[model samples]
Target: MDRHSYMSFYNIFDKNLLEKERTRSFVLLNIGDALKNHEIEVYYQPQVDARTGKLCGAEGLARWNSPKAGLMMPGKFIPVLEAANLTYKLDICIIRQIARDFRKCIEEGTPIVPVSFNFSRTDFETCNPYEELQKAVKEYNLEPKMFRVEITESTLMSDPAKIKEQMTLFRKAGYEVLMDDFGSAYSSLATLRDFDFDEIKIDMGFMRNFSDKSKKIIRPMIMLAQSLDVHTLTEGVETAEQLSFLQQAGCERIQGYYFSKPIPYSEFVQKLKTMDCCDDLKDCEK
Candidate 1:
């Protein structure tokens, strides 16, 4: 290759790399501002008691209403936030939003159910999550029992001692801790024996298969949780057959599209009202 041609190629490659880094930097700068400006929203997906089919609670999932990118799911921004060392900031924002919504529900006479929020491993490593959560609950006049914390199996595997310390703090503060996406990591069985989690959330992948082979694996897992006297929940259940199988397998709780998708606070409030009315009607009929 000619010297001039090589120089031109190098210049083009460097320019492309610089442009990519600039774009990433821009997105990282905007995440914090987005939280401050109310562009980040918390959507709630309802969980139901499998045996009674009654609404039990909801999980708080974060969504970004980016001015530039439109509505973005967590999958798009969470990793970026974690990489930028801003996961705890986003976690605090979600907790504040949940507190505000929970207070509103109480004022409106809607039944207040516990809502679980996810915490990244970065959160535990970077800050005191238990103290932050305690402050938020106290500021919003919320009982600690009104909130739950979900940590994935991979998160537990990241640093078991630190994670367990945080989990112990959460328990002491009256918050129930859930081991989320169980069976998705190598230490699932070991973590169960080690941590005192209030519930275990089976990963959605099991529901995706739901074959005879999957059943052999899933049934025993649920039974294991039951045997330990811990509650079991399965996510991503989207069909009657899957729901039936989970219920029969002794799963105590479920959260997935089979019940309803993660919805905005307004719609979730309406759902709460509707469920309350239905329950009242059934009581009257009885």
Candidate 2:
């Protein structure tokens, strides 16, 4: 191509990219407003008991349907909020929404199970996540047993001492703490030794390239958590083979597209009813 033509094309491309970046940054910064307006929604992905294949629990994930931006996934938005130091806003939104769903299910006598959500490092650095969690629980009149607090392995590195103390507070308040993405980062055996985590969540990334070697790695992690007396859950189990191995390896809970994908909690409730898991749900929390 001619130099002048190439230069003209590059300049226009750069300008368009810059404009898009600015627009995204504007939307991300004002996500605080999105929270208040109920524009951010929660999608629940069901967790099944590995032993019985019954609905046991679910995780609450964030979804934003932006009028201007269309559907925003966690990958598209979470980092932007984290960069803006506004992650706590979204954290509290999901926590409260999950609590509200818990209340709605119980009040309607619907078959219910615990819902897990996460706390980013910003939740600790920017605000009192535990206090906000309590406010939401009380506001919705929901029990702590109906919730699990997930923390990624990397988040523990942000402030290990402070997070350890905060996890203690959560435990004392009857909430279960899970080490999310257990093998996704530079895992610290020391972190596991220090924190009183009730569960270890093996990440889905490991399943993407599932092989004999993957089983070699996953089996031992599950065994380690078992030796430590913490429950084990593996996410992203998308096939019968994945489910078979995880179940055989004694993963207590399996969450992935093998059984279901993330959906509205109302739809999950309908699925539970159809599964006839009501009788089993009574004992799932145990």
Candidate 3:
């Protein structure tokens, strides 16, 4: 190709890239509005007990159906929303959805299990997270203990004082607080010390090496949490080998596809019903 043609093509490519970025901003703006209009749905991922293969709990992950985008996951829109300083808005939407689902499960006699949802650093930075959570809970007739909050170490470690207050308020309300993605950052110990975490989720990176590095890290961490009397859940157990490793390592619970993938609320309820029937059948055999 000639130099003139190549230069023209590069210019057009640059303009197209710039236009894409501009379009992303516009899409995010619409997403913000759509969220306010109740356009988001919550997806539940089951956390299973590695020992008994029972459904323990589920994580509350968000999904949005945008008129333009068709369907979207948090990863696609959250960063853009955060960039626009709208994370708190998104957080509230998620919290409300979780409360709604909890109510539904309770009404169905499903023994409301804990649902873990992520909170960013901004959620802690708020001056009144305790009252905010209480208000949200009341709105949906949910008890504080019915849900769990997973805050990253980075959030708590950002401003120790604020996070401490936030944690105290949440505990006061009888909510179980968890340190999510533990050991992924440098601030795990500090966050644990500052807040009385009810659970600790082992980072997936560590779990991936559970078999070969058992004695070195995973086993010790499991033992350490047991000694402290705090529960531990291993994330990303996608294979039987990994599940066996975690079970032998003394981890109490796990969340991954080795049991079942995350599903919509209706589907999850159906699975629970199936589980109940299976349990009844086993009892009959005995």
**When superposed on Cα atoms, how far off is each prediction in RMSD?**
4.9, 4.9, 6.5
**Which of the two, 1 or 2, has more lDDT?**
1
The Cα RMSD of model 2 versus the native structure comes to 4.9
Error of 1 at 232 (Å): 0.3
Clashing pairs in 1: none
Residues 1-286 of candidate 1: C-alpha lDDT, one tens digit per residue = 7766654333445887786576567669798689879999999999888888777789999999988879988986788778877899999999999999987877766776788999997888788889889989899788887888999987887798988988999999889999999988877999899899999999999888779988889999999998898999999999999999988999988999999999999998888777632232122111
Could you tell me the lDDT of residue 179 within candidate 2?
93
Q: Across residues 1-286, which tens digit of lDDT does each residue of candidate 3 receive?
A: 7766654333445887786586567656686678877778888888877777776677988888777767777877776766665667777778888877777766766654577888777655543556667888888777777678887787777787777778777887788888888878876766666578889998988756655754467788788788878889988778878887778888988998777777888987776666622131121111
Q: Candidate 2: deviation at residue 269, Å?
A: 2.0
The positional error of residue 57 in candidate 2, measured at the CA in angstroms, is 0.4
| Candidate 2 Cα misplacement greater than 4 A, ranges | 1-20, 278-286
| Per-model TM-score on C-alpha atoms | 0.89, 0.89, 0.84
Question: Across residues 1-286, which tens digit of lDDT does each residue of candidate 2 receive?
Answer: 7766654333446887786587668666668677877889999998888998778888999998776677778877887788778889899889988877777777777778778999998889999888999999889877777789999878888998889888999999988999998888765467788788999889898898899999999999999999999999998989999988888888999999988899977798797677745253364222
Instruction: Sort the predicted structures by TM-score, highest score first.
Output: 2, 1, 3
| Model 1 ranges off by over 4 Å | 1-23, 276-286
lDDT of 3: 0.74
User: Candidate 1: what lDDT?
Assistant: 0.86
lDDT (CA) per prediction: 0.86, 0.84, 0.74
Better of 2 and 3 by TM-score: 2
RMSD of 3: 6.5
Clashing pairs in 3: none
lDDT of 2 at 278: 28
